[model samples]
Target chain A: MKKLINDPKNVVDESVAGFGLAHPDIVTVSADPLFVARAQGASQGKVGIVSGGGSGHEPLHAGFVGFGMLSAAVPGPVFTSPTPDPIVAATLASDGGAGVLHIVKNYTGDVLNFETAADLADAEGVRVVSVIVDDDVAVKDSLYTAGRRGVAGTVVVEKVAGAAAERGDDLDAVAAIATRANANTRSMGVALTSGTVPHAGEPSFVLPEDEIEIGIGIHGEPGRERIKLEPADGIVDRLLAPILEDLPFASGDKVLLFVNGMGGTPLVEQYIVYRHAAEVLAEKGIEVARSLVGSFVTSLEMQGVSLTVTRLDDELTELWDAPVETAALRWGR
Target chain B: MKKLINDPKNVVDESVAGFGLAHPDIVTVSADPLFVARAQGASQGKVGIVSGGGSGHEPLHAGFVGFGMLSAAVPGPVFTSPTPDPIVAATLASDGGAGVLHIVKNYTGDVLNFETAADLADAEGVRVVSVIVDDDVAVKDSLYTAGRRGVAGTVVVEKVAGAAAERGDDLDAVAAIATRANANTRSMGVALTSGTVPHAGEPSFVLPEDEIEIGIGIHGEPGRERIKLEPADGIVDRLLAPILEDLPFASGDKVLLFVNGMGGTPLVEQYIVYRHAAEVLAEKGIEVARSLVGSFVTSLEMQGVSLTVTRLDDELTELWDAPVETAALRWGR
Candidate 1:
């Protein structure tokens, strides 16, 4: 694996340290427990939002930590879930007078660990709410997840829920918003190549040169099927079809069409995917009220694109338009 | 060869269309003689900043065309300079009563074409000032460049100069600031793998499994040397050494250290590099007053990172902190 890293075992800690250093104004790194908390600490009475998972999908949980977004992020080893300790530490660190909300992807390890952490935090007299995001419409179950794996749509959950939390919503309200966002959203990805895990030093999976995996998960899990390489538009159709149908994002519905690049894909290609996806949505009479096109949630250096469609209500749209100051998703602030 | 593009021939146009679609609030795409102009058009009497070059290095040029940045961007074919016609068109589109300033990267085709476009625009009564950015400290001259090839430092120049122009700097004042930014900045990149041009259907260059190209050009041109793959810190040291020496950055100098990812490299690795680079700078007593990380300028899907440091004075620092709302880079609104 040709990666720009030192001792593979140190990837998470070193990368988190670097992230903290680069965005000192936004976050403070807690090395022992390995969680990134808001530099200014949790706001006095606002509900604190915390989300985390494995480290490979960067700019995810960590990059999303800052004002108007995640209050803290606990990144585990690459593609490996964080233990209950860091999650509890992050939970306590982020708990303001109002409480704390945990937005976790639906991976089994992550869900279990965050649940354990939430229980631990609750024992300490903290009111904690946990929302599991399983928006990937690709599969019903995966190797690492009992249900649909949370892919790019986790970003949407974080953004909308983070905005609610930022507005001083109570823990239950924030959790409800997060759960609602997850229910309204759906995402599916296609990978041209698999990302190599640093520690493993080999691609998580291997595919023939001419085939592409449709409905691929973020952690290189098996997708619905592998098909021969097709044109960009065809691939977009395949990825978007499942997401649109799963959400049943019907005509006249307004939605946020997010075309996320899976690590190695360039922004140019992501735009191409966006163009076709938008065209398809337009044909269905779905108004593209908002759009996000970039590499937000990714699978290490995997080369592909994921299409996420989040059905938007007036309140959701307003919250989506709210100010967010995270490293990965910042706007209006 | 695995890229998310349709007809390799239509990559630029389609990608630019996607860009315009994705960022309708920021830019309006002009088709016939293509150029992405500000959605609000050129602000009357304010110096218009326009930059362009080959298409592959995205978010540079087009992505930078928005408020407090370029008024317009002319993109050529992938890795091929845009023709003088589109350059002239973009120059005309961005020209307000004050004038248009072309921040051309120091490339043979780009420089020649922008020069021709400037003269053509001048003939049509648009005042045009051109600033050639040659900040790459890797080599004095290489394959497609006469002198040093402009690399990531072009982003710094466009940003600082764009801020100056946005604040209503005149043609000369904006040009001077751009030139100063270019003069004070230096950059060097290392590529673990070469990016394949869409049409070419082959990698730009090939390296052994355990080797890396130091000071590699954005176009996959040979760098200072190809050495055995080393630890991330050692590689960061190699890339930073020449950048610091070329600028002869002094102890008292305050600089903006930009760690840019070359498409395929994950943000985690880029931060690893940033961490080490910051440490080295601190050791040298140079304070990092500003920081810009992530893939702003990129070689399509090339797995690498580039380090750019621009010596900042009070004026430049203030301008650097100015609001920029581009598709790729946005902060401090």
Candidate 2:
């Protein structure tokens, strides 16, 4: 209840407007349907990349729109998926002659809406394609999602796929790279506290002060397991054990490791987790070719951390290293 | 209490080691007298920028080391200023033929230690100058600081001054620009919840559930005022009023507005604060030429936001726009 917002209904409206004003050089906020697109417009002969979900996971969908990243991002309310209108609008706005690709996270609402939007765009001759990301290793089924939930690995897919698209890859090529990344990446998270949904005016869940939730979804959905809080290294091992085994990464494997903070976790702590993660990986003979540690995707003010591992090939590695100019992730630009 | 750290006693040691490992491409961490320096040493004829203080305010002195930011960063233990050895070593390591500039925050320990380091470096035949940042508009005096506490404006001073140094400005020129930036910038902050120091195993301060601390220092020192929790807009107004009045930013004035989160606040909430802040500024006819919103400098996982406004001249604006590559802040590089 100590959240900083007014009316709860206007959080999305005001935040998106504020985001557009702050990064005028990076994005252009559109009217009517409400979507964020590149301020520089579509690149000639380049495929347009579009991705979005609920608004709470910031720097994910919206902040990831700019040169070398997403061409457009359509955000819904805090945790609700956007309707088809905005998705279709974003596709239209970002499309160039090369076509457009829609990156959908694996949640029932998001998947359905984005798929509907892609159909509508393709019918209008936009040549749109959809690639789904289901990288969370936490649960096989959830109250809000079927199969696995899309967690932090979405960031990896966006960066690698965005890099490929920036290199003037065809729509199919971009989608192919994105789908491959989605298949290769796995993420799992632990939450010490639950996030309060703005409109609900209360936390989504509550736990004892000494207990913790392992494998929780970003929205505070129940995880497969809950346990007493442990030390940093032990907790990191718990999160990473399932992920490394799920990916089944072996000796001599080159990988990109992303240690992400759930909104309230500190960077210093994330790095501590990363240090242990690196040690664990080294013991298993897995070499981290590229690594990122920060809060790129987050639940609103949840104190936790998630670990995502993307086994990379030369193509994925080169794409990740390519230039990206976005509000959240920027390099080589 | 819910921090992702190993031993409370080893938080700083492990975290710094982890940071260096994660960013090997950007920095080289030295032992004996620990300091982080650019992986690619000093520029031949350009002045070097060096900074250090307590370790809790992350991405401040350490993450800002690279090509166009600080050449070297010396980190102390959490909430404790580094000793003279590391500071002297950083100054000596970063010093090129053009001399070195130490950007010191106005905290008593930091100022005294950095001054001592400058003296030591000077005796060692390295030309060194120091610029102190006291832009916090909070208390006129506090327990740990004599003047205002140096909060978020340190980021602004580092970026602009680092850019000037990167342009091969002489020692005096770089120090002068840094001084002017420190003088023109003003900041104020409010914390909804206090951050816990690891060793203490408790929050730096405490407030009731419905109460808030206004003008709180980064180290959780007592602020000038405390009041009931308010909405985001009202809170933004409260924080911005003192900063704007102190700066007396006038009509037609161009400024850089930095909305920094104190570790725990989410990006969405920060943008909401920024949205309202822009409205308040436009009402006064001030033009914001540049804006940065993130958790750049933080006090562990404190839930608060700091507002910094830097009045910009043509030279300052150009320097601000110049390409600089660092782990935290990077644009046009």
- Predicted complexes: DockQ each: 0.80, 0.79
Worst 10-residue lDDT window for candidate 1 chain A reads: A324-333
How many clashes (backbone atoms < 3 Å, residues ≥3 apart in a chain or on different chains) does model 1 have?
A: 0
The Cα error of candidate 1 at residue A253, in Å, is 0.7
List lDDT for all candidates, in order. 0.91, 0.91
Model 1: fnat (fraction of native contacts)? 0.65
lDDT of 2 at B75: 87
Docking model 2 quality class? medium
A68-184 in candidate 2: lDDT tens per residue?
889999989999999999999999888888899898899999999998999999998899888889999989989789899998999889888889898888989999999999999
Name the lDDT value of residue A171 in candidate 1. Answer: 84
Off by over 4 Å in 1: none
lDDT of candidate 1 over A1-333, digit per residue (tens): 898999999988889998888889889999999999999998989999889999899889899898888999999999999999999999989888888999999999999999999999999978888999999989898999897889898988998898998887888998999999999999999999999999898899998999999988899999999999999999999988878887688999999999998899989889889999999999999999999988889899999989999999998998898998877877788
